[model samples]
Target: MAQNHEIANEVLEAVGGRDNIASFAHCATRLRIMVNDKEKIDQNRVENIDKVKGAFFNSGQYQIIFGTGTVNQIYEEMEKMGLDGSSKEEVKSQAKQQGSGFQRAIRTFGDVFVPIIPVLVATGLFMGMRGLLTQPEILALFGMTKETISPNFLLYTQVLTDTAFAFLPALVAWSAFRVFGGSPVLGIILGLMLVNPALPNAYSVADGSAQALRFFDFIPVVGYQGSVIPAFVVGLLGAKLERFLRKRIPEALDLILTPFLTLLIMITLGLFAIGPIFHSLEEVVLNATTAVLNLPYGIAGIVIGGLHQIVVVTGVHHIFNLLEIQLLERTGANPFNAIITCAMAAQAAACLAVGLKTKDKKLKALALPSSFSAFLGITEPAIFGVNLRYMKPFVMGLIGGAAGGFLASLFHLAGTGMAITVLPGTLLYLNSQLPMYILCNGVAIAVGFVLTWVFGFSDKMLNEMKISGK
Candidate 1:
C-alpha cells in the first residue's frame, strides 16, 4: 500500500503535478494520461519509476506501461491523490483528436470490427475441431468412415462452425451501429433483412446452385450470407439517417417514424445500390489481397511479417482486422493470421533473448514475463517495454519475423481463423496445418533468439539507458 502511494506521488511529480493533467485513465496494462502540456512530463523519469516498465506518447495521450495487475493498483493510488479518473472512451476521444483524417477513419473501422473478432475466432476454432474430427485417419480409428458418421453429428458440427459466419453481417452491423451511436437492435434487424431466406443465398448464386433475383435484368439481388462490406455500409448509412430523422420528426411521431423510414430507405438502397456496388468493390479488394499474399517466392510474407511490428509501433495495426475478416468471409480461411503469428513469435523470442542476456535484475524481471505475454499473442509489453527500447533487438526480431513468414508462405500455411496468434493460435491449425505452423514458429524463435543474443544486447547498452546491473 505504502509503495503504491509513494509511486503514485513520484508519478504525479514526474508528470508536472496535478495541475498539468487534463484527464487520466488506466486500461488493462497501462496508465493513460492526457496532459495540459506535453512538454511538462519527464519521459525518462516516468520510465525510471519503480514498477514502471515503459512509457510512450501515442495519439494524444502519454501512456505509461505497468504490466497488467500493477496498473490497476497504481491507478487506485493516483485516484486517492485527487486525480479525477476518466473512462477509456474519454481517453480514446482525446486520442481521436491527435491523428490524421485517414488515421481516424482507420480507428473507426477498428472500433467497429474489434468487437466482432472474438465471435469469428471462436467459429474458426469450431471449424478446425470439426476438420480434425472428420479426418479419415481419425475417423478410421473410431471405426467410422465419412459415410458411416451419423447425419445428426455432422449437422451438429455445422451448427457450431457455420452459424457465426452465416450471420456474420448481423454481428458486423450491430457493432457498426453501436460505434456510430445508433440503435443496435435496428442495425441487427436491418442486417437480418440482408440475409433473409426469401432471397437467393450469395454463395449459391456464385456457385451456380441458385440464380440471383434480377431487377430490370441488370441489378442482382441475393441473400448476403457471409458478406461484410454491404452490411457495414448499410449500418453506417442507416445510423446517420436514423439520427437525422429523429431531429426532424416530432417526438410523438419520432418513436414510430424514425425506425420505419430509416429501415425502408437503407434497405432499399442497400439491396439495389449499396449492396451491389460495395460488394463488387469488396471483391476487387479481396482479389488484390489474395494476389499479394500469393506473390511468388514468399515475398508478401517477408514484407508483411518484417514490417508488421514496425506498424504496431505506430499503433495502427488494427487496420489488418478488416482485411482478415474479409479473407475469412470470402475464402473460408485466413492466410494473414498464419503470417502474423510468425511475426509475434519472433518478437517473443527476441524479448526472451534480451531477458536472458541482461544481468540487470529489474530489467530481467520485466522482460521475462513480457516475453511470455508476447508468446500468448499480446506483444505490446515485449515490444515497447523491452525490444524497441534497444533498437538492435527490434531489428533482429523483424529479420526473424521475415524468415518465419517466408516458411509460412512456402508451406502455404493458412489458419481457419483470425485474431488469435502464437500459442493460442494452435487451435486454428489443429489438422494438417499443425505441423507447418509449429515449424514456422520454431524457426522464428530460433532466428530471433540467436540474432539478439549475438548482436542485439550488451551491458553497455543498459548502462546508456541508465539501467544498473545488480
Candidate 2:
C-alpha cells in the first residue's frame, strides 16, 4: 500500500511534474494520460512508482495500470492537484479540433463505449454459449437430436441471454452519468422509464368500446430495452442538468429540489427531443448499413473483412452490434455477425505465425494460447499481450482478417446471433454457403500463418545485434 500523498506526488512527477500533462482521466483500473509530448513521459519511473503496476502506450494514449481499488483514489488525488480529469470533455474537444468527420464520429463513439467493452464481450459470450448449450431444440437443428429440449431449459436460456440486454439501458445510463459527472441513480431512473413495465402507458384502447380514450398520443417514446444510444444521450443531458440545478438550490433543500427539477426537465426533453432524434439516427444508420451490405457481396466482404480489426481496436466494433440487435429484434438473423468471427480468426492466425517464428520460449508460450483465445473471439489477450508487442504479427493478422472477411462475405454467410467463440461459431454458418465462408476463413488464416512464419523471424539480425552489444 502507498500513502495517499506519496502516490499522488509520484503520479504528478512521473507525468512530468503536473506542468507536462495536458489532461488526465481514470477508468476502472487504469489512469489515462495526455501530455504535452510523448517523449517527456518516463515509463520506467512510473512503473517503479508505488501503487502503479505497469504502464503502456496505445492508440495515442498513455495508460498507467494500477492494482485493484486504487485507481479511484489516485484519480481523486490527481484532481486535487488541479489535473483536468474529465475524459468526456477532452475527447469531445479533441474530436472537434482534429480528425475527419467519419474519424471524429468513430472517436466520439469509442470515447463513450470503450471502457465498458470487456464486460459486454464477457457477458455476451457467457450468455451466447449458455443459449447454445441449454437449447436442445437449437442443437437438434444442427443434427444433435439425442436430448429432448425442455421448456425449463429454454426459459432458463432466455433468462440468461435476456438479463444483460434487459439491463443495458440502465448500464449505459449509469456509465454515461458518471462520465458527465452527475448522479448515476437519476440516470438509472430515466433509463428505467424507457424499459420499466411499471410505467403507466400513455394511451389505452379497449376492444368494441363505444368511446376510445387516448391519454397521450403523438408520444414518440419507445421501449429502450437492449438500446445503446438513447440512454447515453439522455444520461449526458441529465448529468449536466443535475450539476446546474445543484448549484442554484439552497444546500438544505438541494437534494430534493435538484432531483425533482432534473427529472422533470430531463424526462420531458428525452421524450420530446433526444429520443426522436436518436430513433431517427438509428434508422438512418440501419438504412445506410443495408445499402452498404447490399453491394456486391464480394466488395462488401473485402471492405468489412479488411477493416474489422481496425474497427475493433478503435472500439467502434459496437456499431456492428447495432446491426445484430436490430436484426434479432426484427428478422431474427444477422448477416454481419460472421464478420467478427472471421476477424478473430485473422488475429489467431497472426498469433500462430508469431508463435512459430519466435525461438524465444517466453514469446512462443504467450503467443500459442493467445491465438487459441482469439479463435474463440477473445482477442484482447492476443492483441495486447502478443501481436501488439511485435509489429509483424499485427500486420499479418490484419491481412489474414481481410482475407477471411472477404471469403465470409463472398458466400453471403450470416449468423443467428453473436457468438462467444469464433472456432465453433463458424459451424453455425453451415448452410449452402458454409464451405465458402469456412474455406475463406481457413485459407486466410493459413496464408497469414505461413506468411508470418516466413517473414517474421530475425535470428541472424538478432544475433548480430547481440554480438555488437557484446
For each candidate, the alpha-carbon lDDT, in order, equals: 0.89, 0.66
* Candidate 2 lDDT: 0.66
- Model 1, 109-191: lDDT tens digits are 88898888888989999989997998899999999899998999999998998888889888888888888879999999989
**Mind giving the per-residue lDDT tens digits that candidate 2 earns over 265-331?**
8877776678767867866877787677667746776677667777766645655655655554334
Once fitted onto the true fold, the runs of candidate 2 whose alpha carbons sit more than 4 angstroms away are 1-37, 41-56, 63-153, 196-221, 312-337, 360-393, 411-441, 455-470
**lDDT at 131, model 1:** 79
Against the correct fold, how does model 1 do in TM-score? 0.96
Candidate 1 residue-wise lDDT at 21: 91
Global Cα RMSD, each model: 2.1, 7.6
User: Candidate 1's error at 77, in angstroms?
Assistant: 2.4
Top candidate (TM-score):
1
